[model samples]
Every structure is written in C-alpha cells, then in structure tokens.
Target: MPTSVKIFDTTLRDGTQGEGISLSVEDKIKIARKLDELGVHYIEGGWPGSNSKDIEFFERTRTMTFKNAKITAFGSTRRKDSKACDDINLNRLVDSGVQVATIFGKSWDFHVTTAIQTTLEENLNMIYDSVQFLKSKGLEVIYDAEHFFDGYKNNAEYALQTISKAQDAGADWIVLCDTNGGSLPGEIAQIVGAVKAHVSTPVGIHAHNDCELAVANSLAAVQAGAGQVQGTINGYGERCGNANLSSVIPNLQLKLGYSVLSDEQLKSLTSVSRYISEIANMHMPINQPFVGNAAFAHKGGIHVSAILKDASTYEHIKPELVGNKQRVLVSELAGQSNVLVKAQELNLDFDRDPQKSKEIIEKIKEMEHQGYQFEGADATLELILREAFEGLEEIFTLESFKMLVEKTANHAVVSEAIVKVKVHGETIYTAAEGNGPVNALDNALRKALIQYYPDIKNIHLSDYKVRVLDEKDATAGKVRVLMETTDFSSTWNTLGVSSNIIEASWYALVDSLRYALLGRTRIEREDKDQLEQLGVVNH
Candidate 1:
C-alpha cells in the first residue's frame, strides 16, 4: 500500500470567495454530499461565526449523514484582548457541531503588528489559547499558520513560534499556508522541511495560486513530508484561486503513487469537478488539467494518427482512470485517421468504405472554410455522419415560419412567432409569444412538435453563443451560432452559419431538435428490431 495523504477540500469555505460564486445553503449541502462521495478526508464547511448563511449551512449538515468526509468549521483566532474561553468566534466553532476545527492565526510579525495590531506574544497566546480551547470541547483542532512561508522568510524564529505554540496546545495538524500565494516551489519545500524539523505534530499545506505555483508548491510541500493537502475543487477561490484539488488528487494518486482517494473515488473526480462548476453557474475551464474537456483531446493530424495507433503516443495516462474519455477532434487540420477514429466513436461504420471517410474529411474542410466549426459541436458532426453514411431520415420538414415584433407605447417589446411543419404528412401549425424573437420561435417550434414527440420536452437549450465570421463586413457579415442543448442525461452542441443572427439561431435550434428526435427514432427502431428477432409480437 502506498502512503496515504489526507485530501482536505476547502471548496465551500475558500472556494466561495471566488467572484460570481454564491451558494445557497442548499447548494453547499449538495456539494458537501458530492465531496463525501469523492472520499475527501476533510471538508471545510465554511466560516461559521462570520456569516449567518454559513451558520445555517453547518446547522443543516448536523441532520445529514456523511460516510467518508469529516465536516470541519473554519474561523480566525481569538480577537485582540479577548480571552479564548469568552471569544464569540471560538464559542461559535464549538457550537458549529463539526468534529474538526481549523482556525488561522497571524504568522508574519508584520501582520501581527499591523493587520491585527497586536504584540507578537499576544499573537502566540491567541494561537495557543484558541487551539486549547477548541480541544477542550473535544474537537480536533487544525491550526492554520497564515502567511507562514512569507513570515518564515522574513522572521524564521517568530514564524516557527506560532506553529510551536499551537503544537504544544494540542493542535492535531499544523498547516502552513502560503496566504499571499507568492512563494515558489523550491522555497515551499525548503520551508516545509524546516517546519517539520521544529514540530513533532503532522504538517499540512494550504497554498494559493497567485503565482500559478499553488499546485506545484503543494506537491513540493508533500515531497517535504507534509501528510495533508488543502485545495479547492477547480481551484475556485479569491485572486487566482487556491490549488485545484481536481489536479492535485490525481497527481498525488496516479503520478506520485500516493494513496489519496480510493480507485472508485478517483473515478468520480471529473463528475465532481463538473458538478461544482454547474452549481456555481460557472463555465468549466475547457483546458483545466486532468478533468478538463480538452485534457486528452487530440487535434493535430500527426498526433491523431499516432494516438489512434497508441494513445500513449500523446496521452500521459488513461483518461478513463479519472472518469474522462479520450477525444479525437475532427477539423480542417485533421487527417483521415481523425475522421475514422471519430466515426468509430460515434458508432459509424466507415472502415469498410474508405471513400466515405475521405468524403467526410473533405466535406469538413470545405465547411470549415465557410465558417462552420465542428470541433465544439459533436452533435452536429454526428448528424452529418448519419446523413452521409447511414442515410438519416428526417423527423419533420419545415413548411414556413413567421415572426412579428411589436413595441407598446411604453416601449415594452413583445415578440410572437408562428411555425408550420409537416410530421408524417400531417401539417402542424402553432403560434407562441416570448421575450424575444428567438425565444418565440423556440416556443412555437416546440409547441408544434411536442404532440408528436413528447420527449422533446426533455430537451432544452442550455447555452447560445454567436460569433461574427467577418468583422470587416460589419452589419452584413456572416455570423456563426453555437447552441448547447441537454436532454437531462447528456448535453450536445450544434452549430449554424448565416448572414442573419435569427437565421443562424434558427438553423442551430432546428438541428438540435432534429438530432434529438433522430436519436430517439433510431433507439426505438433498434428495440423493435431486437424484439422481432426474439419472436415477440406487438399487439
């Protein structure tokens, strides 16, 4: 068995400090459940005494049950001139009902003198008293020496004294935080090694990413004998964010051969990362390491050919180990192998017909030249494959559509759309109103089709983005629209190009619906075929 490093996730506490990340108590609980599912050792719930929302979050977790992660409450050391026993913050930590308590105290003499406006002796007293008081309440105290790295560099003796005080006061784990996030990896390793020499208690690392070295510094600290790693999922925090646990966990487990999470738990890393991003209403960084969408995607022609032969040619490790799959991107720069690999992944049989594969590659190059980008729109690519190779049948044919926009006397604009389509030779006409022309068109189209395909209700547009292909043409320039739709189970993107924005949006929207309905029809046909082969008669 490899040595185990405790995975301490501070997504709820530090991660919430990220801009545009605001979680309701419910959102925090949902995320906490996911973290527990991921087998994190400790989850810093939030700063209990700092806000009512955090207080309510802890209150809600008391009724919940977690199988793996221990809930920890975070706060600062006792305030100036306040006794630890009487401090409101310390008392709130005890009342938070968490088994673990993590509190930060000033380690830098500058912070002690200027930030806290306290003497060095009083700062040490605060650290000692707070840890002892929390321990007296039967809580596991984890002391966070804020700015320990910078403080160690400035005044090594005083920096070591803060952690020593907590150690003597029964701190379970003394964590050295690079609060300013400016320390390099080399400095972190040397400082952490020095701290281990001074304290008998286990040491941990809490690093930020201002210098883009949080993950590097964290790994460096671990190499220096730190047993616990602190980070936020997707690196969500203030400034440049904290070290990303999505990257850190896999590195510690697979790359370094340290046991941080179980194999099953490790596989949930990608889902956990996306889940947090969804809850935060933030776009997951496409290039984020280990868990990003493009992490294992091959694009270069030579790279794709090599990857098709052996993924090890370009990939560092099997993406499936972390619940991510390898992707072969098809584009103008892609080779014939890229087309074949993508076709195979989509269940298209292009192996026996080399001409069809060549046709797809040429068609993609021609389309890309006309402002059609298929790289981000897999559903659109699948549609093209089915049409070219499998001979996809149309679910519905559009007859005509009209839109009307009217502004009231008060300047409130209202848009309405009428759509006409033929489903199995039956004409369906519907009308709807919406806040905008595109929305109205979406509503009218759905109303016309929902009667024939009830599953259409499950499909909703999640995102819509538009880009002008030629900026020099200005108003007359061609525009490209990318639309993302989800059917509750999976999400897909489609692309459209036209001179008119509404026309572009309409093309993408129709493709989205057609792709979804076509998939359902195919599955139904397959089921019917299977049943017929099994001699089951339908009444």
Candidate 2:
C-alpha cells in the first residue's frame, strides 16, 4: 500500500495573513471546528504568543474536542543565541496547550545572514533546540524549515545540515517549505527526492501560490516520497495564497491513488470550501478549481452537444467525487442541444419541435449578439421559454411610467416614481418614493399590483448589478442589468439588456417580481432529477 499523506491545514494561521483577511477569535474557532469535522490531520490554530486574539483562541479551544484533527499552534523558533527553555515564544507553545506545535526556523543561508543577521551555525541550533524543547513538552513537533527550497538551491550542504539537526533532535515531522513559492514542480520533486536520501525523518511540503504552482509543487513533493501536505482551504494566505487543499486533496486521493481523506470527507469538499468562504466573508472566486461555480460548467456549443450524448467526452472525473455538480449554460454560443437540454431541465414542453428549437436558438443568438446573456438569468430564460411555448399571459400591461430625482443643498437627494398599469382590464395609477430611481420604480410597480397579488409584499429585490457591454461605445454603450430577488428561503436572478440603462433596469426589475408572482411556481414543478443535474437556480 502507498504511504498515506497527512493533511495539515493552516488557514487559521497563515491564511489570515492575506490582505483583507481578518478573522476574529470566534471566526478562528468556527474554522477550527469545521476543519476538525473535515477530518484534517492537523489544524494550525494561530500563534498564541503573537497576539491576544490567538491566545484567547487557544484558551477557549483547550477544552473542545476534535475527533480526527489535532489542534496545532504556529510560531517561530527560539530567538538566536537564546536557550530554548528560557524562550517566551517556545514557552508559549507549551502554554497554548496543544498536542502539536509547529515552529519555523530559517533554512536559507541568505535569510540567516542577510535577514535574521544570525550566523549560519546558530540557525541550525535554533532548528534543533526548538524541535527538541517542544518534543520534551510531550507535544508532536512539526519543524517547518522555512525557505527550504531556496536554501537548498543556494546552499545545499547548509540546508541539508539544518533539517539534519531537526531530525537529530527528534522532530516528529520535517516539512520542507517553498517559502518563496518560486520553485517549479520539477525543481520541487528533484530537491525533495535529494533531501529524502539524507534524512530519516518523514518529509512534508508547504507550498505557496505566488507562481500559481503550489498544488503542483505539493504533488511533486509527495510523488518524491514526502508524507504530508500543508495547505489552507481555498488557498488563503499572504501573497498569492497557500496551496489550495480543496484541489490538492482531490488530486492526491482521486488522481494519484493516494489516501489523504476518507470517501465521505472527500465528498464534502465543495461544501466545505464554500462554508469557509462564507464564514470568512469572502466571495468564492467563480473559477477556482474543483470548488468554483465555473469549475465544471459547460457553455460552448460543441462541448455542450458532446456532454449531452456522454459527459465523459468532455469531463475528466465525475463532479460528484468532490461534491460539485455539472452545469450546462446557454448563450449565443449554444447549440440546438443546449436549448433542448436546458428547456427540458426547466420542464418546458418544447415537444421536440425542431423549428421551435431553431427559432429559440436564433432568438438567443441574436439577443446575445445584442449583449443579452442568459447564463446567470435562468429566471429570465424561463420567462422567454414560457412566452415562446406556453404563451403565458402577462400579469399586467404597462401603460406608462415616470421617474424624478431631486436634491436641495441642505437636504438629501430623493427619488420618486409614478406608474400606470392595466391589471385585469382595470387601469390603476400609483406613485412611490425611494432612495434611487430603480427603487422608486419597483415601489411604484408594487403599489400598482400589490392589491392583485398580496404575496408581492413578502418578496424584495436583494441585489442589483449593471454591466456595460462596450467600453469603446462610451456613454452610448449598451448595458445589462441583473436583479436578484429572494423571499429569504430561495433566491433567483433575472436579467435585462438595452442601450438605455433605465430601460434595462426596468426590464430586470419587472422580471424579478414576475418570477416571484409566476415563474417561481412553474419552475418548481420541473423534473427533479434534471433540475438537480443541470442546476435550475443560479445565484
């Protein structure tokens, strides 16, 4: 059997170093609990000696129990020329009350002389004494040889001596760090392989993503016999970020035949990635590998047409292996199959009518050429499908609408809208006030129809976005507007595009309420399996 790779997650420690990433002690505790549930081998809770917040985190979590993960503390090695036993940082490791302690010491000769101003011999002693002192405290010691790769390239003999000292001092894990994150996969493999012959200690890799090669470097290290992989969820860290464990675990377990996570834990990868992003208050990048919204999305005509016949023609692995699902997107780039597949998934009765399919595809292509994209507007797409095939009657016919924005020197700007509409052949005129023209329009429309559809009071537009299609067109550029609406339980997106920004906002605003009134009921009755597979709701 192949050696099992240990996963050490450092999101709470190294990850928070990234710009705009600030987690409170409560957030750190939440992440630690989730990482424990993720079955990671170790969770590097922050450095207790460095800050009051981390000290509080260690104190609070000292009594909490984790089934699979050992809570670990991160800190630097004892200061130069100091005995490990007398060091405040080292003693804080013992004080942090964790079973495992990870201490990093400089490995690069350049950092030793130029950065730390320490003699080469003392750096080695720092590595040795720190690991030994922690081991003496009955804590599992993970000695991170900071800048190990750069150190090896610049002074191979000295770098080898540093870890040799840690190994001699009984460090439980000797992890090689690509601190600069500049080493390529081949260099990583070659260096780790060379170091393997010199040390009897189990090896590990800690890679960053400055060059976007952290995952590759980690895998290369493992392939060369490293036993552990240290990374953070979603690659959160300083600089480019740390190696993304969401991608690394799957690559090791599924692609490379390595055992890193259990089958059930592996299946929870996508949700875990998003859950952390939510708690961290960061939007998960849509294109992030494996866990991103676009990771398995297909939009091109040829790809969609092929995947419909056999998904294997395009996809490499079943998306469910990492808890992600395959999504088919429709646009001007779509083929007839894209229309047919998405329509069926939404339970639209196209009835296999080739001409109807052709006409719909043509309309979509024409609209996309005019800057209308259906990719994020499934609600709007449903409205189009209903109008074409079902001939669904309009909820209300708009007669006319007017908006006014006014400001006085001493008072805040105010917006008001007047709307007229014929509901069930009875014309109604109403007006409303709002902070913006779009809000005012939405209010006036609601005022016009609230009596007919009392449920409209329960729904509100939660998000509104506008994108200019052509920069060169300048002020005349066509604009696209997307409105996100929710009743708190479920949310959906609607879209509209036109050269007139107000017109675009009007269309999307109207569709959002129309979906709340009509399309929501119709979309819910679709085939469950198809909806689940193709993804009916996009937010």
Candidate 3:
C-alpha cells in the first residue's frame, strides 16, 4: 500500500509573500474554498499575530465548513526573552480558533547568532517552549525547523537537537525547511534521513525554489521518509517561489504512487491551478509541467506524427488526467501531421485533401516570413482554414475607419474613432470613444455590427500583446499583435502582423469577431455541434 502523504497548502500564507501578490481577505476566502474542493489536508490561513487582515480571515472563515482540510494558523515561536505563557504570539495562536498551529523557530546556529541576535541555547528553548505552549492549548502543533538543511550541513549535531527538542515538546509534525532554497536534492535527502533517525514525530518537507529545484528536493525528502509536503499552487511565494504543488502533487501520486488527492479531485488540478492564478491576476507559465497552456502543445511535424500514433511516445502521461488537452500547433516548422491535427482540432473538414494540406503548409510558411505566427493564434488560423475550404464569404467588409487622439493642458487625453462598414450589404456608419486607439476602433466597429449580429455584444477582448519583429528597424519595424477574446466561458487567441501597429491590431480584432461570428459558441464545441445537428442555427 502506498503512503498517504498529507498535503499542506500555504498559498494564502507563504504564497502571498511573492512579489506583486496581494490578496484581499475575500480572495483568501475564495481560494480556501477552492483548496477544500481540491482536497488538501491543510490550508494555512496566515499569521493571525501579524496583522488585522489575517485575524479577519480567521474570523470570516470561522463558521465556514471544510470537508477535507483543516484551517491551520501560522506564526513564529515566542520572542527570545518572553516566556511562552506570557508571549503575545503564542496567545494569538491559541485564540485563533483553528485546531492546528504551525510555528517556526531558528534551527540554524548562524541565524540565531547573526540574524536574530540570540544565543544558540535560547533558540532551542524558543522552539521547545512554543510547541509546548501550543500543545497545552490542546491545538495540534506542527514545528517548522527553518533552515534545517543549511543548519544540518553547518552543525549536524545541533540540527538534530532542534527536532529532538520539538519532538520532546509533543509537536504533532516536524517539517524540515529548505528556507534558503540553495540546498541540492542529495543534501535534502540526507538531512531528512538524519532527522528521521533523530525523532519519532512524523516528518514533512517545505522547500523553496531559488535554485529551481524545490520540487526535486521535495521529492527527495519524501523518498527519504517525509510523509507531508508543504507548498503553494504554481509555486507562489517570496523570492523565486516555494515548491509548486501543481507539479509536486502529480509527481508524488503518479510517479511515486503516493496517495494524495483522489482520482476525481486530481483531474481538477489544471482548472484549480488556473482558478488560483486568475484570482491572483497572475499568469501561469505556459510550459509549467502537467497543467499549462503549452504543456502538451506539439509543433514539430515529426513529433506530431509520433504522438498521432502513440501519445506516450511524446507525452509522459495522459493530459486529460490533469484536465488539460493536447494542442497541435501549426507553424513554418509544422508538417502534414500538424496541419491534419490542427484542422481536426478546429473541427475543419479539409476532406484529407493532400494538395490542400501542401498548399496550406506553404501558405503558413509564407505568412511566417511576413511575421505572422499561427502557432499562438488558433482563432486566426481557423479563419484561414475557413477561407481555404469553403471560400468563406466575408461576413462584413470594412469600408474605412479613422482614429483621433486629443490632449489639452490640465485635461485628460481622449481617443475616438469613426468607422464605416457594410453588413448584410447595408452601409452602417458609427463613431465611439474609448481609452485607447485600438479600444476606440473595437468600440466603433462593434457599434456598427452588433445590430446585425447580436452575439457580437457578448464577445470582448480579454488581452492584447504586441511584439517587435525587427528591432533593428526601430520605430519603422513591423509589429505583431496577439489578442485574446473571451465570452466568460471560453477564450480564443488571434494575431496579425504589420509594420503599422494599428493595422496589426485591426487584423487580429477582425479575426476575433469572425471566429465568434462563425460559431457563436459560448459552451463546449461538442455541445455547439450537437445543437447544429439538431437544426438550431440561430443560437
């Protein structure tokens, strides 16, 4: 039987320490609920002793129900000079109303002498006193031996004594911290093994990623006897970040056969990861293992060919296991397999026309030479295929558009656009104001077209990014614009490239509208197809 490794998530606590990450108490509450749905063993609410916000967090969630996770309060040990019974930090933990308390103290002699200006003996007493005080309050205590790896390397005997003291103080769990994040995996495994020998308390590992090895070190610790893994989703924390439980959880359950989240909850990993990143207003790295936009994106023709026959040839695990799907990208580097797969993914029936595939490949190569990249712009590529296969009639034609920007002393800058378009062979003229040139154009064009296509009102641009294709040309360089549009249900990426920035934006913007116009889908593509099969065209 595999060991059930307890997952302690600190996204609300340590994760908020990451640069630019600021979560309102409401954001923390929402994240806590989602974490419960994901079935983690514990959720650290934050240090109630530090601020009013953390206290408010506990107060807000006091009556909330969680099925799988305990709300744990985080704080440091008693002050060096204060008795545990008289310490404010200790008393705050007891008053926090949470059943669990995690407290950290100096495990490294260097930190005691140089960082905290305390004697080594006093540091030991701090760890022991804090754990005992919390235990006396009938709270389950987890002692974090901060910098245990570096401390172990400096003075192995003293490092052993910290956890030994914590165990003697009746701490429920002894978690070793690689706080500096500089220790290699071997050092982590060896030190954790030594701690296992020194204590009867269950062991856990909390690793940081300064060296990009937090996940590796965490796995090493578990192999060497740790039963709990502490981390945040997408590795959010101070400095580089903490170990990413998004990667750690899958690695533990799938590779090491450790029982963590259930199979059903495991499948929600990708959605949960995206949910947190969205709420944080941060972007998850596209290549993050197991649960990123490009984790399974195959672009190489040969790679696509191999994956078509056997996904395991190119993929380590089934992407659906983590709620992500394989995406076939077409570019100048693409081959026939990429074209076929991409066409199928977009539900475009090219009828397996060999000549058509060859033509499309050449066209994409030519477009790439012009700085147009279809790989990251699926909606634009879909529009291209629609033109190729069906001789798709233009839904609307742009007659002309003009933009104006004006500024005066002691006044805000203003932007406006005038647009003329022919929809259903009827000329419509409209003008609108917006925050920027592109926004004005979008608003003006949308104003002209929404009367004909009401669903256009539902689609809105979510993101826009521009890149210089030739920096040597400087101000005259061609730029590529990528735009994302979403209907709050799904999103599509469209792009265009031109020497004129506004021209590039217009191309992407038009493709965005065209894609939405063709399908008008706000639900899954399969559902849209089912509705179409049932003769529900107006929807």
lDDT score for candidate 1 against the true structure: 0.93
TM-scores for the candidates? 0.97, 0.92, 0.95
Off by over 4 Å in 2: 424-428, 447-460, 523-539
lDDT of each: 0.93, 0.90, 0.92
Evaluation by TM-score, superior candidate among 1 and 3: 1
Candidate 3 TM-score versus the reference:
0.95
Find the candidate with the highest TM-score and give its number: 1
- Candidate 2 weakest ten by summed lDDT: 520-529
Task: Compose the digit string of candidate 2's lDDT tens values, residues 446-508.
Answer: 999999988899998988999999999999999999999999878889988999988999999
lDDT of 3 by residue, 290-344 (tens): 9999999999999999999999999999999888899899998999899998778
The CA lDDT at 486 in model 2 is: 91
- Which candidate leads the pack in lDDT? 1
Error of 2 at 209 (Å): 1.1
- Arranged by TM-score with the best first, the candidates are 1, 3, 2
Better of 1 and 3 by lDDT: 1
Q: Which prediction has more favorable lDDT, 1 or 2?
A: 1
Model 1 misplaced regions, further than 4 Å: none
